[model samples]
Target: MTSFLTISLDFELHWGRFDKTRLRDYLEYYQETLQVVPAILEMFEHYGVHATWATVGSLMADNEEEWRAYMPTVLPQYKYERYSAYRWFDAQPQIWEEALFAPHLVRQLIDCPGQELGSHTFAHFYTCENGGSAKAFRADLKAAKTIAKSKFGQELKSLVFPRNQINEAALAISKEEGFDTVRTNPQDWYWKHTVDENLIKRLFRTGDTLVSLGQKTSYQAPQRNGEELLGLPASRLLRPFRKGSLFNQKRISRIKEEMEAAAKSGEVYHLWWHPHNFGHYPKENLRCLEDILQNFSVLKDTYGMESRSMGEF
Candidate 1:
């Protein structure tokens, strides 16, 4: 079998970060993201790369009214009130008109060749949050599919749970809703499903990007649960470009080495990141991406490694 390279992006704007971020602080980053998407599409097209955009369903709306209309009846009820996406919207609904809505961008994504639209859940729903029931998760997914079909005239086939919160019960609902596959966390211990946040795990995750501190994450094949959805476990996160970072070259070198190993060994190497990760330093970020893709081209020549979207893989 030929080695495969897959890229999936979590394309949520303000929706994914409402719990931890204040929009005013990152307004410039969001603004740059609008430019980043088109550039990313151009680069992908030029490199013959196919990617899945796991979009937040709310980003499918043209305005706040459309977004509100598609919201699920029962929202996530996390013990930490500030973690609620709905409550944050309730506090300042008007701000969504500008910050949260991104239907135009989603339209651009659909038009871009080789780009597949997938679900990141409606409203960036948190599946593992304590107070949110399985019923609420299903309701949220139903809203996601409904809006996606109504807006794009296409059924969503892949999902990436918000905050990497994978709920087994929710996977059944995802399959019932018609997803072909779902992106899961890497099989490393640090990336496993957990409600409790740990500083050591967080630090290790960050450090892994710059150096191979843990396991080699490449996979040879996907797994299937009883739900019948293919489990496309992630391999690595393409960390964003940081200014004055001494490890920039080391990070890129680590990614290229991993890709080469996967290609030589005939395994799948999946890389993912958010569009906003490129938002802050568009030029630098694009250059880093180009470097990775350039290495992929070399791998293709030597080993016939192929590029695939999540659904395609």
Candidate 2:
């Protein structure tokens, strides 16, 4: 198989973090995300990078009324009430427009060349959380497809589970709902589970970005499962740029070295992050992205590495 690089962004604004953070505290951070997304798209266009924006279905709404209009009939019933985004929306019905919804940004993704509109589930559904079921997951996927087709005239072919919480039943339901591809976590000990409370695994994930802590991050393209869903395993996260951090260059170098290895071995290297990751230090984060893309250009020219959206696989 040919060497490939895939980029997927978890494009939820506040919905992704609402369970763990106060909206008031992160307002400015999310507001900045509104600006960062377009800039990221511009860089992708310049670099001829193909990406999948795995968006929260709610963010596609133009306003609160529209978001409500598209809400799934059956909501995820996480045993931990806070994990349910629908319940959170119920408590705070009033919209924080810039922080909550972004149909305009969704439109930009559609307009951008080589960008694919993919699902991050309706309401940022957490599949692995307690009380979540296949029934709720199917409802979420339906709502996601409904809004994307109704608002943007696009059918979502790929999915990225919120928090990389991949569940087998959820994958089966995704295929039933017409999704052809989904991003899965790397097949490493640290990535096998998505428990947020596991500090050791989390530390290993963070350390792996700078120093190798696991197996080779890049891998051969995954074959389709019996369900016919393509499993696009993530290679690494493009961690947010830290201002004046001694390890910033090392982080970028780690990714470059992985990309080089993938290029030489004809494997797939998948990198992902949230657009809001660039919200805080836009200039620096974007520069880091450009640096990586520059390396991708070299790999493309020298080794025939190809850029692909997750859906394309």
Candidate 3:
């Protein structure tokens, strides 16, 4: 098989972070994200990069009533109440439509060339949290598929677990709901477990961005899990561009070297990040992206590296 590059974006504006952040505090950041997504899509088109936007299903709703109409009948009952988006929604008197909902942007992602619209669960469901159940996860997947078909006439075939919390039971439910491909965390020690802030894991994950600390980040191909979903292991995260950071060039160079290795070996290099990562420094981020894509263009010319969406793989 030929070498390939896949990019997936966890495209959940405030919904992804509401549990940890106050919307009012980062209003400007998300506002910039509104502008950044479109520009990012334009660059993807220019670079001929195929990407998947694993979107939060609730963002497809144009209003609160519609959002309510499509919500899963059974919501996740997390022991830690803050992990439940429904509880947060009910507690808030007013919703910031621009920051919380984004049907327009989702539509743009659908119309963009070489883009796949995938699911990030109905409510950014955290499956690994205590009290989460298989029944609730099934309901969440159903709501995700229902809203996508009803609103966009599209079917979701790819999934990315919220916070990279992959559950075996949830994978079975996702396959039954029609998602055939799922993004998995890299097969590295730091990423093998659930999302957490272990000091050592954080330190190593950050260090790996600037230097190799684990196995070769690129892999051969998607593997079939016992649950029957095609597991696409992530290679690296395109870290947000940091202005005047001394290590910025080193980080980009590390990514480029990995891409080259994948290209020469005819392997796959999967890169992912959130659109809001660029919300604060879009210009610098886009420049970093363009630099990376320019490298991909070189590899494409030299080694026939092809760009692919998750579903396409």
User: What digit string (tens of lDDT, one per residue) describes model 1 on residues 80-121?
Assistant: 778778888788634835567788888888888888999999
Worst 10 residues of 3 by lDDT: 219-228
Positional deviation of 108 in candidate 2, in angstroms? 0.7
Alpha-carbon lDDT, every model: 0.87, 0.91, 0.91
* Residue ranges of candidate 2 with Cα displaced over 4 Å: 225-227
Tell me the lDDT of candidate 1. 0.87
- Per-residue lDDT of 67-179 in model 3, one digit per residue for the tens? 99999999888899999889998998777888988899999989999999999998999988897889999999999999999999999999999999987888878888888
In model 2, the number of clashes is: 0
- Residue range 184-299, candidate 2, lDDT tens digits: 98888889878554989989989999998899988988877576989999999999888779999999999999999999999999999999998898889989999999999999
Compute the lDDT for candidate 3: 0.91
Error at 302, model 3, angstroms: 0.8
Q: Backbone collision count in every prediction?
A: 0, 0, 0
